[model samples]
Target: MVDFFTPDQIAMLSASTVRCDFLVKFEFASSTMRAWNGNTELVVAGDTYLPMFGFGQIDGLGMSGGTVSENVTLSLSGLPGQALDLLSVALDDTPEVDQQMLTIFLQLFTDEWQPAGTPIPIFRGFMQPPSVSRSAMQGTEGATQSISLTAENIFYSRSRPAYGRNTDRDQQARSPGDKFFGFVASLISKTITYPDY
Candidate 1:
């Protein structure tokens, strides 16, 4: 059996393209921009936590336990133009064959839709370097060995949580996009500070 978490070992996998439905959910809950790249530091993307609660001897006394949630980390880097080429070189993949799907919208183009909905498709394609086969080479003395190729899925997204009593809906209902947007618009809307390259 193979241990998936040990990425340092011998084989190098590739992720040439990804196709999917809905949006590829990130921490900011936004789509990826094409022309962004750099050696950016890792940041907490998002979290999905399940709160634990236990009942005490008294009916009203409920003790709150620890929270369990999956945390995601995102490290954005590299210029858009060089991303595919760089990733291919670093991952030992075929740059010529990999199209490098960058946006969630682009993924929808790859599918064959049905009447209701389509399958949630994700992909990882790679061109592996050739390994010399001693037994096979003996039979065909003149021909050279061919490189091994492989592709597989590595990551997947999970469903978001349902709304409850303590949900953000109450806050939104009260303000209706008024709080932060109004505050920022009044304070710093006129500022045109340039971004650091």
Candidate 2:
């Protein structure tokens, strides 16, 4: 009998590391989206913050069974809408912003870690700040809003993760590592509530 347990356990252990990397990537992408979306409030030093009144994290899981897949839908009715045509997320510099994004990603990874244990490092990957486009919207009441655009078939995937060794591992572990990745990815589905500034 091929121990599905053994491979699954090792995969979970190795995935702990990979999970951290995945979360980091998701966080970076989220921050870039918010910054480039142009709805964030710019602070005194030009740093932007998610608008306080409308900011919230959308937490959920996505799953695929064979060719069919499902993800939780989030409501973005509380967030401010976009204005800029194409926001540039400067990735050429390694500054506090980049470090903050990394730290945030790690925190998010741990927070979403399922079948929770000590957080472990599992994989490594990076993405270029993607090419951006924008879409404009108009309300019947004469309001204007914009959205950062996405194209069809723009698929991207990171290296698969292998998790850390599970010591005193429970045979009935109810959670899977893929859920962590799905949750992080769902952050990209942010919507705008107030579009016109």
TM-score to true structure, per model: 0.16, 0.22
Stretches of candidate 2 off by over 4 Å are 1-49, 52-61, 65-140, 149-197
Superposed model 1: Cα runs more than 4 Å off: 1-94, 97-136, 139-141, 154-197
1-197 in candidate 2: lDDT tens per residue? 23223444455546646432212122343344332112344332233323323323232333322112222211222244423212234333323123222211221123443323322222222323332223344555443222221111112232223433121122123344434334333443354356658
Residue 180 alpha-carbon offset, candidate 1, angstroms:
33
Sequence-dependent TM-score of model 1: 0.16
Pairs of residues at least 3 apart in sequence or in different chains that clash in candidate 1: 27-45, 37-78, 38-78
- Expressed as tens digits, the lDDT of each residue in 1-197 for candidate 1 is 43322342112122244332222211111222221121221121231111111100111111122122222221223223342222333235334323233221111213232111221222222222212222244564644322222221122232345532223353366556644333332342254446746
Against the true structure, whose TM-score is highest? 2
- Model 2, position 126: C-alpha lDDT score: 32
Total residue pair clashes for candidate 2: 14
